[model samples]
Target: MSDRYELVLTCPKSLEGLLAEEAAGLGLAEVRAQVAAVQGLGDLETAYRLCLWSRLANRVLLVLGRFPVGNPEELYQGVQAVDWQEHLLPTGSLAVEFSGHGSGIDNTHFGALKVKDAIVDQLRRDSGQRPSVDKLSPDLRVHLRLDRGEAVLSLDLSGHSLHQRGYRLQQGAAPLKENLAAAILIRAGWPRIAAAGGALADPMCGVGTFLVEAGMMAADIAPNLRREQWGFSRWLGHVPALWTRLHGEAEARAAAGLSREPLWIRGYEADPRLIQPARNNLERAGLDAWVRIYQGELATFAPHPDKGQQGLVVCNPPYGERLGDPASLLYLYQHLGERLRSQCEGWEAAVFTGAPELGKRMGIRSHKQYALWNGALPCKLLLFKVVPEQFVTGRNEPAPSQARMIGGQLVERPPAVRTEPARLSEGGQMFANRLQKNLKQLGKWARREGIECYRLYDADMPEYALAVDLYRDWVHVQEYAPPRSIDPEKAQARLLDALAAIPQALDIDPSRVVIKRRERQAGKKQYERQDQQGRFMEVSEGGVKLLVNLTDYLDTGLFLDHRPLRLRIQKEAAGKRFLNLYCYTATATVHAAKGGARSTTSVDLSKTYLDWARRNLALNGFSEKHRLAQGDVMEWLEADRGEYELIFIDPPTFSNSKRMEGVFDVQRDHVRLLDLAMARLAKGGVLYFSNNFRKFQLDPALEQRYAVGEISAQSVDADFARNPKIHRAWRLQALQG
Candidate 1:
């Protein structure tokens, strides 16, 4: 066998350049970086060095042979041509990994199988015994690449990926991979900091992945030093003396590095559960003496290293992929930036996050950003210099305090009121002035009535057609789709102006404002999801907690305009069987339960909405006794035999859901829907029916069957008094004879 070899190093796609630089430093020659890999030439010792040293590489491949393949027979012939006896014994085990496909080999699995069969058949003919396939571990691992009808086969030299590191047996919900963590630290210039004898801290460390990786890198420790298994460990061509010599040198270097005075490394985790695991990881890496971990929170995050020491503050905060919404995470990032600026004024910082938009909200400008991948998701490594001038928000002021809720009542606003934003135009200033005037008038009543969510403004001006509503501290803005006659550019400019004026005028952060376009809907389009963020927050209405997701659907789970109706349902539902039909999120059912209803049944056509309703019910101590049924409301009403004394129906204007038998229009189907609903209404019980269709007309024939009286005037609340046409309501009951 030749002492020299051609090698390939593969990494995450965007890390090829970094990998090339690393391989060159590890004594490889002719290093050339490709899309997701680097190619180079190296001797056996150089290849072994790369395996033990590379932090960005996922695998290392030592080329065995390269040949042109045109068909399956050629593929088999080429593989069989290689002397398999040189790599593995006839009684040993092997694993084959194949990638890319062509030349009549359409499936990667089939190609891999073919290669395995060729090697096994060749060995069987020679010794009457064949090697078995062991995917997890084997005497040999082979990788075949077919590109443009050419095949290149190689033996994996790194065995399992070098990222395992053997220290992280327990991790948080979403921990960064060890190799990816190393790549991030390198890009953030952690090596330079450590060489200068500086400190490193992670305020949001989870299971100490970052802390352990950073500690190992700073101490000049080989990442895979603890690995016991390797692809070449049992290979037939293995050089035991050469491997032993290299391993001994690495051991000497590590011992010398670890014996010296340690660097200042610390990690803080909010979860106490993660603190022990993080310490375990540090201890396992033999780095427990060098690094320290404490249970702490973001608001009080502080790293008080030696007075003269300065270093990098690194963290991988939650990116809203699994936990909170992107909007909710805004406060976390903003607070992180604040901490860095206030506490570590002269230190550097690096934030690795999948949500760059949230990163932009940090109020500090990033000097550099590197693209990286977290598994399949693309992410950004944001680098910043913690200097006073780098702050984007020039105002060195604390965030505005949020409104508090006590027993679902709007308690009080801050004593300080903010004026209009100086950036607003003449029209925008006027809009802002009007909103303030309305808030002053509506604020007093909302506080007294314990209404935490209400409409602050509703297109009171012709220039800006928008609806602004407040759900506790959050503001939901909906721009009414302007008529075609209006100029689109002018409309957009006015909308931007409106958005700018909101934060200053309302005394809330820009992150709390959610904007959406409002337009008419046909068929099931109205019920269609606008976005799929799945972010939900709880808001109180009449002292009851209800969940509202502003990002996921066109309408929030709770309707502000229907506040009075929900309140009315709670008042009359005591000791009665209450039924809520077309219950979008079962907000009304929650009210009825809190109002002392003996039993409650909610019916809706959407399983999604029903699931949401289940959560809403569960949020308020309600259980299976408060039933939530999934099916067509019409069909369910026809099948339901239980009688309800109090019934509320607030349905869509039109629906053509596939789950239903036929299309439904409130104008055309109200009579049939009401008849079915009224059948189950017990004597002396009242049914409340409501809709939002402005053109809807109630049938005159319904008055002859029962007592039907319009209750639209009483249903309109103070917040929606200007838009009386928002909804129409009626009270229907059995005739008293």
Candidate 2:
């Protein structure tokens, strides 16, 4: 083998430039960027150095030979012509990775097998002992790239992808790969920031990928130093002395960097389970002391006060993959932008998201956007300098101060009232006064009961037909379609008044208020999406976290009126097998799981709601034993063979989903639905059936077979006290013969 051979360092396609720059910086001669790789001329020492230090490289390869091949026969001959003995011992293990396909090589597995056979046959003929194949931890890893009847073969010198870094023992869902994380940091100018001694933070960091990567780059620590194995470590041409020298130099640099001033790198995750994994990864990377991982929600995220004033704030927020509609993700992006604008002034921000449209909702224009790929998903990295002048609003404004504490509510002076004059008609003024009165009354009750989500006003006035629901600090308004007798312009003006009054009276940002129309539905119209904004917000109820999408549908996913019923189920769910049928969003099931139910099964017809149900369960730390099934609830009930100790059935008043065989009317089908559910209930099990059909009546036949008692009065909470007819509930049990 030549002392200086052509080498190729591979990375994700969009990171070619970064890889090339890194390779050139490492002193590799003739460095050139390819489609998804960087090619250069380097000896064994250079290859070893890259394997130890290159953070953005997937693998380092030593190009062996290239040849034109039109068929497997030619492929075999081309691979066999190479001197395999020079790279691997005759008895050593080997693995072949084949990419691309052409000329009878349609199957990657078949191509790989052919290459392996050629190598084994040539080695056996030359040394009488052929190497075995070890796909995992192979002594020699061979890579073959076949493109349009041409083949290039190389010896994989990195063994596994360098992204492993040998420190991530656990990861959250949809984690950013290590190399991708490194690429994002480099693009965000993390290196320059670190050199200047600025701080870094990832508020939505999952397992601290960005934090750990940034810490390594800041400390000049080798990326792969923690790895115990490398492909070149067992190669016959390996040079131990040169490798040792580069390793010692990297170690000395790391030691010196560590002894200097610490880099203030921090990661905050809402899921506490994820915090430990990040801590473990940082510890394994020898950066535990330099990085801090905290458990906090994004709304409460702020830069550490002791850290420097400016740095990089980066995050890879969820992109509505398993969570369902993309419309629900807009709120997250909006909140992220708000947080960066309000708290991260003077810092640079980089947001990596698969959904670019959601990024636009942030209201902060990006100075730069780079098209990147997170595995197979197309993504964009939005770069921003968090400056006050760049923000569309809330810039140069001081944080709101507590003006007065009414009924335990700290009313902050709203920014809107300061900038714009309050405009209201005589009727609008009356509506605004009613809203304030309701807030004072219900807000006190909500605080006393620890209810973060509750209805403050439900169309109390005739002129202003709207329902105002409070979700923690945010407010959601639902406008009832006005009567046709009223003038359209007049009704619209009144609605504008209510919308204008809500933010000012509640002391909340207007941006936090979402408005939607509620009308009597005909069929599946209510379930159809009104928009594709995909914005979801987390809200709490009785200590359980649930997601609500205020802009996507007619409802906010949670039925504030059902809060009492959910709490009742939770209190009665201990040591019971709980079932939630027609479980829209499964908030009740989440309550049951939190209440120590042995197991919980949530069944819903819509795939969207099932995804929402899964998220709700995960948010509360429920195990996989809490199952969510998507299917027609009636069909599911007929198919279920397991018995449940407790069941909650709260079907929609009416639904005509395409997935269902027939339309469902709760008033007409309540008996059949309840019968099917009760048949699966264990003897003496309690079944709570509830519906929102204002005039619903229990069938006389159901009363004959079960001991039924009305519990509507007990099931309604203080928030829904004024609207007792909002929903009705009943307790049913099998009657002894």
Candidate 3:
């Protein structure tokens, strides 16, 4: 055996370019990108350095043997033929992982078992001792992949998935996977942005994944710098002295690249829930001192704090999934366009979304839109360059009061007031004051950190006293709610009227803001349905056609809380059976289906909601294998359980409807819901369950029942651009018994 050998490193699908860039930066030779891996010639030191530094990889696989195979037995024979003694210790523990297609050895587990037996047999016969099998954490990790009937076995130099970069101290709802975040950054040409001192912003930044990733990339900090262990560290051939020297060198390089505010990075949200997590993660990544995160609504996002000719504004907003109507989302996007055109000038902006049609509302021709994968779903990253003057002038709409243009300057005239504090009660005043402060601080934070569109308040704020909560187009305050002397019935009308006056007070076109009101639900009169009551057409500030409608089953017409999860659904729903449970209006299901899923089926007990689901699907032109049914999902699954490749389950936190079901509380019955979902899931399928119930707990029994991963990172979108933890979302996969 040669003392040194050539090795090729593989990354997750679509991350080959990033891996190659990392390899070449490390001075590795022959760096090239393949389907899902990068190939290069490297010695042991080079392998160690790559494993220790590469940010956009899942694992570092060291090629051991390569040959063609047609059957499982040939796979076994090929593994047995390798000189095991050269790389494997007779007594070390090992694990075999397999991934492939188009071969008789198609069953990865079965193929892995065969290869494992062959390795153990070879060791036992040659040295009279067999290596132990440790599936979870092995002393020596092995990867076996087959591409076009050619099998290549390699030693996994990265012990754990490289995504566990070890810098995150805590996670919020819907945090982005580190490797995936890096992949997005690389795909977005983030390095170029950093090199040119461009800003990096994720309007909806869950747990600060984008912020932290951009910071690391900007500072040229190695992703794995904080990781303490690697698969190669346990390899028999690992040289301690060499590894120490490599780590030291890497540390020195990382230290040199550390920045004292090198690139601008910022994040925002309306909800306060995600702010702490974002701050915590940034701090742990050693980027908090340089990155700033704030809480506010996107409508109020202003970039005037810093005087730059142009910058980059990136947003990953919700795609009407797990929220409300697609129409409302369209309105949000339309409002966002208004904000962008008015605030961001001389700036280049990219909108990462699973929903393509929503791009129409932006009103600007995309410079370039790249097809990329968030996971399995097809997503488009639409890029646009904004002219400064367009952003400023396009923001002004017709003022309810007449304005005078004198000396080429527009002058505003105020109307006589009714006085008496405008009947804006103490409680209403408090909520408005808090909201104003939130927006103010958020603006500062965005300017400081280089992020955009953070959340100021999710629908869950107690002060609003709103049942369904709200997502705003722009953060504005008005004289909502009547005085104490007014009757209760009159007060509600006054409140709505006051709400209507908000746009004028904030200098926004009345047509730009859409409002959903709260009213008594049919049969359940104790509860109110704050549904959309009317329609208003808003001409784009940029000469684009826009529509805004309200008067439906939901008050806000949108749920900004689940923005991150909708993006995740769009990213991972392709070629999969997506079952959306408690699917409300099925906006998220529509997004999943639009992401190119094999089929989509939504389940909810309300006929009204089911009909709404159908309408949403129709709105998106989702006429394929999409179905909406009115039935108790729990009973439907228990009776005729269906398997789904991907599932999105968001149930009401507390509900007691007379529509034949008992009281439904997500916190009380999540286990049963999960169990039902698991029974209906196909092998390797994922289930995404979310609830607005602030304090929720996963049943402990689930630890042994499924392979569960919290995917709050994948949930974030641009609109619900604030605290990630406003809603709890999880990813669950079935585990064979």
Best by TM-score: 1
Worst 10 residues of 3 by lDDT: 539-548
Candidate 2's C-alpha lDDT?
0.86
Q: Give the 10-residue window scoring lowest on summed lDDT in candidate 2.
A: 414-423
Q: What is candidate 3's lDDT per residue for 164-282, written digit by digit as tens? A: 88877677654557887777777667778788778766666767787888888888677888887788777777889998998888778767777444566778777788789779888
In the range 145-262, model 1's lDDT, one tens digit per residue, is 9999999899999898877888999989998989899999999999999999989999999899999999998888898887889889998888889888998898888888899899
After superposing candidate 3 on the true structure, give the runs of residues whose Cα lies further than 4 Å from its correct spot. Answer: 1-6, 101-103, 169-174, 259-262, 304-310, 388-737
Candidate 3, residue 402: Cα displacement in angstroms equals 18
lDDT of 1: 0.87
lDDT at 720, model 2: 82
Please, what are the lDDT tens digits per residue for candidate 2 over residues 485-582? 99987786677667656766777876677777777786667667776778898888778989998777878899988888899999999999999998
lDDT of each: 0.87, 0.86, 0.67
Evaluation by TM-score, superior candidate among 1 and 2: 1
